[model samples]
Target: MILYTTTPIEMIFPCDQTVFDNYKTISYQGVPLVVEQTDNHYRIVQILSSNPNDFMKEELAPGQLISFI
Candidate 1:
């Protein structure tokens, strides 16, 4: 996993979002993404695609929509 900040922050997954099992995978914009659950937070793991900008890693707040085409 890539760490942007030194300290790790705990995140609350969205209740309305799809429940992901460990090692489960999904795709966004044709890019494959793996779902990983840690002791504290869930993660969207993916390999570095050709377009780096296509993979967005950020904290998602409540009521925010994560739309994929």
Candidate 2:
């Protein structure tokens, strides 16, 4: 079988419900981010901002660990 579509593979074959539950959207330092909760910290998943400057910040890069107060 073959599939031809613009949709992402993860969307085509959905992941486990628990996998999706770990992710939550939150605003950190004025920039919106989607993060995954880990033990004692949150892992940056993706930046939801459109500003180019936000992407340039090393601290805001994806996979960075964030500890909320």
Candidate 3:
């Protein structure tokens, strides 16, 4: 039931298993993502890796700090 903005124009609704124990990070197709909590929704803060594939997801791409709000 969690929503994340992985790309500038897209959002990824990952399952509960994708959420990390810390609740600050999540795995989307194996890419670790950090998110910032907004008043109404969550925003993509950063990618926890430098791998090109990490930012290649249609939803969570580099330079695309998408917000669900």
Q: Against the true structure, what is every candidate's RMSD? A: 10.0, 3.9, 12.5
| Regions more than 4 Å wrong, model 2 | 1-13
lDDT tens per residue, model 3, 1-68: 55464452323434554343223666655778877554555556678776986666767763345454
Residue range with the least summed lDDT across 10 consecutive positions in model 3: 5-14
For this target, which candidate reaches the highest TM-score against the unseen true structure? 2
What lDDT tens digits, residue by residue, belong to model 1 across residues 30-62? Answer: 655544555554455443345655544443322
Candidate with best lDDT:
2
Task: Give the Å error, residue 56, model 1.
Answer: 5.1
How many Å off is the CA of 64 in candidate 3?
5.5
The alpha-carbon lDDT assigned to residue 21 of candidate 1 equals 36
Give me the runs in candidate 1 sitting further than 4 Å from their true place: 1-21, 37-42, 56-69
Better of 1 and 3 by lDDT: 3
Off by over 4 Å in 3: 1-23, 62-69
Scored by lDDT, model 2 comes in at: 0.85
After TM-score superposition, what is the CA distance of residue 40 in candidate 3 from its true location, in Å? 4.7
What is candidate 3's TM-score against the reference? Answer: 0.42
TM-score of each: 0.31, 0.79, 0.42
